[model samples]
Target: MFRQLKKAATFAAAVLATTTLVSTAQAADYPEKAITLVVPYGAGGASDLAGRALAETARNYTNEQPVVVVNKTGNGGMNGARYVTEQKPDGYTLLLSRVGMALYPAVYTDSPVAWDDYTFLGILESTPMILAVNANSDIKTVDELLAKIKSSNGATTYAASGPTAIDGFTVQALLADADLDPLSASTLVPYKGGSALAAALLGGHVDFLAIAAGSLMPHIEAGKMRALMVYAPKRMDALPDVPTAKELGYNLAGQVDGWSALFAPKDLPEDVVAKWKDILSNVATNDQWLDLAKKRGSVSVVGDQDPAAFVKSQYELYNGMAKKFGYIQ
Candidate 1:
């Protein structure tokens, strides 16, 4: 009787020990500390503004400490992305990346990294890019500008946000199709952000800039600039008179739209990633979030927050564009 009782007690204790271990290993209430939201662009840029707004809203979704917004601008978000990838995958460090994140791999052959390195939460918003110039500039339309640049015989320059940025290739591709020879007749000046480019344009430092539609709307309202054209397949209702690049004899259509999304390191605990996915999925549908997105001209969308699907989609879209532009095989 004593031996049998001892065996029973010993087995019960061992079972309890194993259960405790497994239970403890499971995900607990996550985000125990402050979360860092890294923006891959400079401050006051469109991406930074959108990212901060999202971070603020995300804070309300949890009772943990407020999220911190960090600008890690370098190599057009590659540095920031690599930084996040190198961090411990506990969901403490998150990347709020724009379309440039995907464009990087597309533009650079044998890129040092790939999108699969990090877990994409979901796309926050996406919008189309546009062509804008100072209101007082002699060039009033896309046709006029093209004629001027081709006729001037003097080099013209354009301001860009970054190399891997959507503006980089989209604008370059536009010039490429025009047979205008961007490098031969135009200088491409890459600034850190749109606001800076706007400043430069206002100060007569740059000839013009190709920015997303939303970023230039405020200035257009102020009468400081006028949109030459909106880079969409169809004319945007906001400015119907302006023709798309395609309508004006350019094959480009809706190629300039960009997006921002959240990502965590791939090593994140599945439960932690799940918790964020759940919270953000609901957050993606919030009225306040939608309103904010509208204000920025970003379309709030219900998308695949699954990292695998997200990365795959990015790979396909960007990779295809790269191949079409002859930037990749």
Candidate 2:
């Protein structure tokens, strides 16, 4: 009986060793083919731009392996996230996770994906949110906008991806901080993507919007739209004159901004994770990446924080906000 038990233990050990060796070998030859980086939103959005930029810059460190970006939009960015989480743990299939990744789970109790569903590679960049109206509009500042909303008796409308999306939360949080009901203070006109949201406001389909600055910076720069407030830790260098939400005393809105990160399905091999870390570190400082971020009104933050910890903290922060704002119980 003792001999039989010893033999079984030896076989198990050998199997474990073989499995580890195979995983190591696979990681060493990672990206033997093209990698698909799925963006969970439609094209022309901040997440899409970030994914494309990363795909282009990553090739420099990926032995020129193509990092293809695929848009799998729907469910307020949950569809693509769920798809990536369901993919094999191999590094080939990854996600261009956005702020929605953390916010969705907090806002929706039945969210299709959870915050920890994937192995976070690292944060790619942080994009500011701009609260703006068409240049043609008379509302010139956040105070004016809020005053108008209050005076309109809930007739004022704002565009966003959805009520649960990060962009939507920006406006909602601002309203909540102003002693107004987030849901009823200003009617939310839901739009599918950043482009649509911007168009909605520009075409006067919606009164105003607080959305990813990347999509609105062009219009704002051209004087087609007027930015009222920036939802970021500080004013963006490109928009130096704009006041941040925190400076304006809208603390909840100040905590809301757009950001993107790289992620793979859970349990990715250590070797694969290491390779991505090195690749992302290099891409962080790539001239093209930096230029794209600057032009898009974002800041590259590839290796500034530990991915796991950052995701966790963001989830907690948004979860608390959601509860406070009554988006979730």
Reference-based TM-score of each model: 0.80, 0.93
TM-score of 1: 0.80
Q: Which runs of model 1 end up more than 4 angstroms from their true locations?
A: 1-28, 109-112, 162-164, 232-253, 302-329
Backbone Cα, N, C clashes tallied per candidate: 0, 0
Q: Identify the candidate with maximal lDDT.
A: 2
Look at candidate 1 and give me any clashing residue pairs. none
Best by TM-score: 2
| Alpha-carbon lDDT of model 1 | 0.74
Tens digit of per-residue lDDT, candidate 2, span 204-286: 99899999889899999998999999998789999999999999988788778778899999998888999999998899889
What does the lDDT come to for candidate 2? 0.90
